[model samples]
Target: MSDRVELELGDLQGGILSAYGKRGFPFGRFLLFHVNHPAAGRRFLEGLRPLVTAALRWPEDVPKPAATLNLAFTFWGLVALEVPTRTLRSMPEAFIDGMAARAAILGDDVGRNLMHHWDPVWQVAPGRPRVHILVMLNAAADREGRPVPELEQLTRLVLALAGQSEGGVVLMEGHAGADPRFQELAALFAENPDGTRTPLPTEHFGFVDAIGDPVFDGQYPGRQEWAKCIGQGAVDGQGNWRPLRTGEFILGWPDEGQEVATMGLPLDFSRNGTFFAYRKLHQDVAAWDTWVAARAAELARLWALPSLEAATATLKAKMAGRWEDGTPLVRAPDWESWQAARDRLATASRAERLAFLTAFTFADDPDGRCCPKTAHTRRANPRDMLDPWYRDPDPRARRGSILNDRRRILRRGLPYGHRDDPSGEHGIVLLAYCADLSRQFEFVQQQWMGYGLDFDAGNDMCPIVGAHGPDAKFVIPAPREGQPPFIATRLPHFVSTRGGDYFFQPSMTALRMIAQGMVDPT
Candidate 1:
């Protein structure tokens, strides 16, 4: 709202803005398509703009209105659309080449290390296009564990609309589920023998998942504080640090770079749009459990703990930088402290809640004493940890890096697979949105997550999620000085890249441009 940061929510796609906010819609489906008939696809793409949600339409309330269903239209599918080839070339090369190419470019440390390297569905032939467009349908789920009938109706409505464009055909469809192997873990985290479920969200990993997500402006009025903590807020040493510049996530506006994004060949076609990387990540629950279970007992004996289970929980928190319950280690530091924070949060003031979760920086604890430098959260954001260092070496510049601005990505998507199917095909469907894949998403995946020089932990991948191989180890500093560090070694691949593709989520305006055959580069 300030004169300096004018974000046009109305101009941006709602899905690109706040579509996944407010704990996200309970039930959703992913539809993948390959453009078969370009003309038809154009019509389809154009028709979709009218149906797409706008950021301005986000409900002001906690829970969205009943029967509320939203759609985000993005493309790998666009390549298959009837647009001219030159237009495709004009787009980001990563978007044109897709995630497989991007992954290959990211090298062995990141992409090749992915479990999906062996996935049958993920064996995408080099240069052979896979998924083209990603149609995300998010709807509220009923207590009966059924997709709301209204959502089904909404699906039919969208399908009918898609019928208007012959630009593409269905390539595949993916839904959220947990493998059968996930049952025990799900029960441990969230389940009852009565066979019923609670609304309390828990990922297949059985940890309180999906915490401390960055909230952009236009999504919520109170997210300014949340944004700043993530490197989006104030760059200057004055004023309230707000959420990252809107352009950092959404295209068209100024980004954390303080520059307007030059999207694709035709600027208008790319404006208000963002790029999304769709990843079907398969979680190896059994492997992750085996590793942790072995360590938890050793830790219990070392700490003289009464229960191995509690020790396991602590190790998990240390691995993820948060307890399975979503309490952050940076704030809680230990089980007792984590619980205290959790209890307080039940009635904590707004300031208390924000500070409890969003507040905290690595500046003071640069040593990874409290929250290990190699923790998943630290790798993903780095907070003030990566403050720009090179230009002037001024204390502030050395602490915060504008490069962090270019690296921040907006995460979306939900878990796929059934909860009780242990060894079942349960995993998370991740949507990483950013203006540039190589700079933002790929950089984080490679530099920060896979390689640890950024954390001063040299060559150490993320202990929990990174591509850890045999003899791999995660060092959790001892709680008190002089105490030895707890090392969890021989970590198995907990999550594998099952299947993925990159697509462009264009602005509604761009969708219309594509549909109307108006994508002239000149």
Candidate 2:
């Protein structure tokens, strides 16, 4: 028995999953620094790599390379940073700074130029991390903003520890696209011709999405549990954490198991390995502006509102169960409530909590009025209102068949993209994590987003953002006991599905092993 167990264990170790779950910060920046020297990339990787990897700890017996590292900011990403806060505090302050200083140390030859840029596809409110450093702050507040002064303070702290550089550049671009400033620097490095230079747009459309999410269990124990299954159990039964044959999220797989490989190096073969499929979706902001402006009166009238802005805000407040600032409508349904709804919701049981969220105007109009049935939220997770409030067609199958482990991806990250709207080219860069994308994420998109068969009999799509053809119609639910259902009206598409793909977030141990060219096919 002992010998058999030993053989089964073989070179396999755990901890990869746990390490990722422990770190809980939002990955504020997806930086891509352009280095002129051949060794620049290596230098940058060396410095940032350690900070990211050193903080990560894996389970025992997992066969991983010494160099691979992973850092996640959100739930999925945070799961990979297994180090305790105490350990992080013990690390040298210099090493905790941004990628620049660390890059300078590893590849001293890379030039120092701070190129600041912004993404056209993203229209985030001003006051967030234009850049990120290793210190903590108060961005966790519901309506809080990340100030620049705070950023400067964090930078000075890094400089004090990491030494000096040639100066730095700031760059921003479409969420995944290149920052204009970064692009300019790149052009300078490559010496591009005058007309050949691609100009950066100040505004655009598309979602600014983050990529690669780690599987989240809980905190410490979650971390430990994950570590124990580095390459064994699926990250969770859901299958979101199932490693690609190449062992992206785990280890102990052979090279051929990978979907792709080159030069003896196992390439990422797992489909949807990248968390968020990032694209700088182009948009005609100017034209969109004109169209909205011209039809402002018409839109306001259709929504029965005083202004288009009010209508938009009204719609948002209803669907999200909160305002754009993250205030929950349930607690502050009156918009003048003293106690915040978000706080209250945070303390309730998972079931009650999900129900309380229905207070959003869309689910239950604050004015006891027109939000109506078949609304977005109602269609997606009808819960008590649609599922419980009313009896199902087949009462026996109601409870069981409805939720039936319907694939449901846990919402784990922020949505990024441009603020401006361009005709029919605006949509969220939906980022979700699941043990199984086929079941959870895809189920919601197919059953809920694509069809209205999940909840009410109304054929309404998400009014504000849902896409229906030129002649799309909304079937409003009847009010009270005897009201007849009404067809609101035929609406044009406001949101369009531009493009999207999924990806996996590997555990640090798994990454290190892959980087080092180690594969255990068995």
- Per-residue alpha-carbon lDDT of candidate 2 for residues 317-389, written as tens digits (9 for 90 to 100): 4443344433444345333341355467567785455334322222234222344345554444433333342
Best by TM-score: 1
- Model 1 TM-score on a 0 to 1 scale: 0.85
> Alpha carbon lDDT of residue 253, candidate 1?
74
The C-alpha RMSD in Å for every predicted model, in order, reads: 4.7, 16.2
Candidate 2 stretches greater than 4 Å from native: 1-27, 31-48, 53-355, 358-373, 382-404, 415-428, 456-460, 481-486, 497-500
TM-score of each: 0.85, 0.44
**Residue 372 accuracy (lDDT) in model 2:** 38
Best by lDDT: 1
